[model samples]
Target: MNTKFEELEIKLETKQAISDLGLIDLTPIQALAIPKMIDGLDFIAEAQTGTGKTFAFAIPIIEKIKLVKETQSLVLCPTRELAIQVYNEFLKLVKYQKDILVAPIVGGESYERQFTALKKKPHIIIGTPGRIIDHLNRGTIDFSKLTQLTFDEADEMLKMGFKEDLEAILQNAPKERQTTLFSATIPQEIKRIAKEYQNNSSIIKAESETLTATKIIQNYYVVKKEDKMKLLERLLDISNMDSNIIFANTKREVDEITEFLREKKFNANSLHGDMKQKERSYVTSNFRNKQLNILVATDVAARGLDIKNVGLVINYDYPQEDEIYVHRIGRTGRAGSEGLAYTLLTPRTEHKIKQLEKFTKTTINKLEIPSEKIITKALENKLIISLKKEVVANTNTYDKIINEFEQEGISKDALLNALLDKLVPSKKVYEVIEEPKQKKSNLSDFDNKKKDRKDSNRKPSKLKDNAVLVKVNLGRKDKITPLIILDMFGSIYNIRNNNIGDIKHYQTYTVVELSSKGHSFINNKTFKYKGKNIKIEEV
Candidate 1:
């Protein structure tokens, strides 16, 4: 445990909560941020994933919080998954403290239940921008009593385009309230936001190692785009992988690839924004427990999720930014354990591959896709390892069987060959051959979360105008089915089923009907398919 934690543990109820969570020491970020946090000075902390930044901010916030029925602390996360993670962490730190409520108000949850919880008057509320905005507009939460605000992953929140909502929420809170922000990098926008709202804030960047995932054997595959899935299947078939994760850029791709893997008999599942909080948690837990072998996910859905024993990470779709690239690889190779990261690249995306190399500063050596011959060899190697293990273990259990075989006039070589034949797979090397494809899908779309469209000049629709023409940069060739697109939007944004009118899957882009709650709700943080960075606008 870091000495810093020992210093603060003596002062608050959070100490017991930390002990319960089995966290005895402060992480590097926690060590530095906690001291400034306890001093009540506004601060911005720059730290990466797995650095315990949540606890760094949460411990101080909970310590300062005067436990009561009324709301006193507010934490805004960029995504529902992240919001829940932060909320749960805070709950652990404040578990033994009586009358302290840590309620999560985020997109994709039941409004009535949240309303009921609010009536009981939570001591703290942690939520995403859209849901918090929803509660603010509905007057479901009383921010007048709010004394502390923390924006976890502030850069990511900005990337999701929550600047307006964040500004509005801070404006509503008391100026004297403590403000804290944590992010992986100190981008210009982060600096700007701090300057605008924070009063004489202290800036602290954790000097700990920035490279978080060193145990992973990072490599890339230079395959034609169409052959990526075939390669994925072949790799899983032969490698001794305990579990795997595939990262995609869009929610639609997550659903499509998950179904494809399932059809091929892989125990696969997908996680993204469209899923309810319960479903997301269930899938994540299953993946972590090894019940699910393959996890297909979007970057947003997988944020702050700590899943151990993930032996491999496949970049089904390359990330747009360097930070995302780092975070994805960081998921594997954790806790001093070795891991493998496979990147499938197409001819067109070769440039992005080089960019990633420069960003990570680690040479991703090119390797051939594992052929049936290579896969068979890998299986043979595994069988050899098992054979060696059997020979070295306590031998009394197997000695009787060997003696019986000896007495039956079985020669040693014949007996050993017979046993090996029974144990190893019968498929010959040639029979296991899988033909590589000429090309594969790119599995990426124009940044939907960053795209934004302007409000149309057309008059508000009448009863028959149920069709809302929202656009996305996915089409037929990209393997985007209607159900997949719907699931994507539903998971990533809070778009309801009935709100969608008609969906026209164009060759290059898709257009769909607007849901019942038109402009006001659609324009909020619930929908990220807008902005100058991405080209999304209403017709």
Candidate 2:
């Protein structure tokens, strides 16, 4: 087998593209599939996600397409997210080749834009089945010139109920076109499609002992639903992950998690089905460029995304299906590189952990939540390291400042402590404790708060001279408890709990007290809680 891409006898331009991508050697799937693809043979490949399968087929398709202004290849994916990902990969491979145009045609995007792109006569089209069928029906796409067709994630397409769409596409394509199908599993549906469309096709499978690669270390933490967010924050703080993807089950969860992380000042963003095409593109591009540190996305939004150096993957919500669990964790640990995956589970979902471990045929070790002491120590260590770097980088400035402080009768220790306090403010550290059981006082406390608010004519608590009252359009109706609001304001705006004076919850609105600085930060800024935008205004 050829180790380097140049050994595959590809054009110099294609080889240069590979080198530009900084890929020195081919992955196992790529090493196996690229040679046969380059030989112009139809085949079915079975490989897990994150095995560099996109390049396996893309390199050959790029090599075979003529420079003529006509569509010569079609790559069909299950979702728009996957389609765009494939198109982006094609763009990278054809970066130096100016004549080749690759267009993504997917649903939920402007048809006018896709039609305009078709007018340019792209050499390759990557899209979903439904959108491709739309173009085919409208006479907007010409498959007569097509020479190669690929079905990426074939099993997923079938699962997404695209079997009819796939049939329509295959039947309409020219019989002379070379067909290739790639899937994680060789189910009967995939085999049936292969038997029907592929001719004399080779079957290549990258065999692995487990569903998940051995390079990925799997772990799980059990916590209550209410404490999930706190646990996540602690895990991120202790682990100090560089690049990570957090997967949720629904778009709502994605939005909520993204909002929470952003409030906490983490470089985070969200991607899901509800977002427009342009918005999705922006998020994906930023993530690929490392401008975003954390991406909160649903499974559909992350399908076929192949960003490298994903140090960790957090399954904030346990997946419903076994395959989803496999795919979610597969985002990390690519190309034989080591990675870590953590799943947050509640007591109700604890049994599912065992089922997942059994299904993956791998061990998932239980991880203990970091203690408050551990987190505080980690923060201290980080602060010391950053201070050391600053001191090394500006020794003369620090010396001058120290001498000035000395002349002012200030001790060096006192000067440093003052500087440290300004740099890192003390906040309440989370304790490594279990969720408290429900108590009658909880309800009584809520009732007393409500009574007090009503007695005070729904006015916020007496504020300091500079304090301001701000109203948020979330209340008891939307499960907006006082604790939730407090956490948000404290984390997002860096307002200490003590600084948050009074919170009065109404039917559809809530008023809270904030210091002048906190009020300024919230004055013109919009906040999102649980996917709904909340307009904060002075009352």
Q: What lDDT score belongs to each candidate, Candidate 1 first? A: 0.74, 0.82
**Candidate 2 residues 199-284, lDDT tens each?**
99879986564368789999998888888888888877776777889999889999999888887778999999789878988998
lDDT of 2: 0.82
Summing lDDT over every window of 10 consecutive residues in candidate 1, give the lowest-scoring window.
448-457
Q: Model 1, which residues run further than 4 Å from truth?
A: 1-4, 9-13, 16-25, 95-99, 274-282, 347-358, 361-363, 387-422, 426-539
Error of 1 at 104 (Å): 2.2
Best by TM-score: 1
Highest lDDT: which candidate? 2
- How well does candidate 2 match the true structure in TM-score terms? 0.71
lDDT of 2 at 303: 87
Q: Could you give candidate 1's per-residue lDDT for residues 213-331 as a string of tens digits?
A: 55668887766656677777876777657788899988898998888789788899999877877898899999888888899998888997867777888888767566777788887
Task: Return the lDDT, model 1, position 494.
Answer: 58
TM-score of each: 0.73, 0.71
